[model samples]
Target: MVNCMKEQVFFGEGMAMVKRDYPDLYEAIVALNEAAYTGKVLDYRTQKLIAMGINAAASDERATKKQMISAIKEFGVTKDEIVDVLRVVLLTSGMPPFTKGMKILGEVMEK
Candidate 1:
């Protein structure tokens, strides 16, 4: 399996800080992530897509970009698939968040 949580947490500087300064909290986060990303029913790719949609809906540009990049790299997720996810964001979150997500997705794809 991909161990999605580790892939996400270990890549970031903030997580490194947490590991050093708050080992217990970091461990708890690791445990929670293991439980959350277990792939028992939905599968990791679907979970990742859900996470991407959530970030998009929240207008979290950085998180949305990161999730898109990771989904593409790890799961071979296509641009069309991401666009489909963004369509849901458009429907539920309104234009601002959806447009922001689309812009971020474009930038990520360009790179």
Candidate 2:
């Protein structure tokens, strides 16, 4: 849950609000996040890439962009590594999501 909270800050806002207004729900969400993100066979860094890819595949522009920035800042995830992830997105999710992900990645890199 602690790890999840830190990541929530990294990826976006609203966690504090949730925690204040809905402590139980916030805890549940955090618990779920912790369970999902716990490094096992896959390292946490690789999991971040997979999460970013999932967001991109869903065409979630804001989440994808935030995740790109977070991964880069946290793990030194390179643009090339992101592009590799997007390559999988292109194949699995098709062009629209792939293009959107690429655009978001480009914007993040520029900044």
Candidate 3:
């Protein structure tokens, strides 16, 4: 049986949505990310960090911080790393989304 814990942090369902909506483009992008990261080199933690960063920039605060904390615990991402990701999102994506993401990140870190 597949481990539930192993499945929890991955994005198979999201990838399925992408595939169903835009098969060619989704496959290409997935290929690109895989090639760039190299399956072995990227590791689950790094992938989770990138996902959290993207989600934060996209204004998905709840999902972003949920993923962020999970990455922190499972992959050992540091508070500084999380903060830096938030800063990058704020700089590139503007304040509204960034603020929301930051609020969540702060709450998670304080615990």
Candidate 4:
């Protein structure tokens, strides 16, 4: 399984720096992350895939790519599943994000 806490943090470089630069704030964020992922109903794998979709919808190329790769490497999420997520992105987020997400998905799957 992909150890998100270790392998690749979803947080950006600025946030990484924040971990050291602002310990209190960073700790709160970390706690929030843990709480959010505790998963009352949906499994972590499903939640992670949803997160990938959210990242894609947000048009964050870096985070989307990382999430996609992690989903595949860790949980074996299929290309079809990603396509389904992209369909949602297309509807709610527009073409740019959907297009970018498709591009990123292709790149990640090719490897």
TM-score against truth, every candidate: 0.89, 0.86, 0.63, 0.88
Q: What RMSD, rounded to one decimal, does every model reach?
A: 3.5, 3.1, 6.5, 3.7
Query: What's the candidate order when arranged by decreasing TM-score?
Result: 1, 4, 2, 3
Itemize residue pairs with steric clashes in candidate 1. none
Write one digit per residue (lDDT tens) for candidate 3, span 3-104. Answer: 112343334346556667988966566556555555487676676677777888887755776787787787788878887887888889999877888788
Can you give the lDDT of residue 94 in candidate 3? 92
Query: Which window of 10 residues has the lowest lDDT sum in candidate 3?
Result: 1-10
| Superposed model 3: Cα runs more than 4 Å off | 1-38
lDDT of 1 by residue, 46-82 (tens): 9999988988898877778888998998899999999
Give the clashing pairs for model 3.
none
Give the number of the best model, judged by TM-score: 1
Candidate 4: regions farther than 4 A off: 1-8
- Stretch of 10 with least lDDT, candidate 4: 1-10
What's each prediction's clash count?
0, 0, 0, 0
In candidate 4, what are the lDDT values of residues 1-111, reduced to their tens digit?
112433337447477677778989777777767877876898789888888888888898888888888888888999999999999999999999999999999898888
